[model samples]
Target: MINMGVSFKIPNEYGNHLSDILEPLPFNYYQWLINNDEIHIVHDNEFTNQFLFDEDKIISGEKLYEKSKNNTYYMVFVTLRAFLKDGTIKSVSKYKEFTESDCQIILAVYDCSYVIFWCKNSQLVSKMYMYALSKGYEDIKYITEEELIKNKYYIE
Candidate 1:
């Protein structure tokens, strides 16, 4: 079963540069890295407004489209446990199967416990959710964008 937690959006500043800001992270961090620019497209124009807010500088949809044309936006999920086949934890990057170029979002399953799903296409987001389920990943919690913002400033 999918466990619904607080859903949060990853800050715009942490957009494509997640690797730079996140520290003291779990070992399977590399699994969240997606270099496929083709997978980050915003399919729904209506929701483009939200992205505009995240981008902060885009004044119009045309501009947003142009700016993101070559870049891919990703939503990554990180889990608390490792889901590797060998039960060995190592930082590594793996490429996803490029079945289609129209894929605009990515659901990054971290450590098999935490999940981060990023994308402008709601359809793609749903697909990723189902994909996760097909893989037998049920202990999933959705973090809120507000939580992410709050976590960014979290001081321990």
Candidate 2:
């Protein structure tokens, strides 16, 4: 399995506020609409909202995107799905702390002002990567799944 993600510096010209981190997650990642089931907003840090605690946060991606895109800081759990040896499932009963060296884990640190633009679809991955690169944003860097899993790149 392959995971795709990218890390880049948000130039002051592009706006430094938290919302700026979302600039790369535009049309290429699929529209912020109701029809697409390909995406899901699995977890977010709104304690008051019950959905944030659901094991499966099926809340519409469009709605969540609209609501959380501008928040200065918010933690998001983008699918805790993991695989076991026999092609069986291995899911955690509760959210546990994940370390950088852990294998096959997806972790995004919110306090750092970073968002992982991740996807499993190769075609979509390629499209997003190329699109971000094409934007000519300064300090934009690609993070291979290996790099991400191993914590090889620095966003700052």
Regions of model 2 farther than 4 Å from truth: 1-3, 11-58, 68-113, 134-136, 149-156
TM-scores for every predicted model: 0.27, 0.39
Quality of model 2 by C-alpha lDDT: 0.36
Tens digit per residue, CA lDDT, model 2, 1-156: 354655543332211222333343432223221111122223343223332223433323344455446332333323322222233333322222222212122223223333344444456456656665675544555557676466564321
Residue pairs clashing in model 2 are: none
Q: How displaced is residue 91 in candidate 1, in Å?
A: 18
> What digit string (tens of lDDT, one per residue) describes model 1 on residues 39-155?
222443222223312433212223333343433343333322122223333222221211122222333433213445444334444554555555454454453434443443111
Q: Local distance difference test, per candidate?
A: 0.32, 0.36
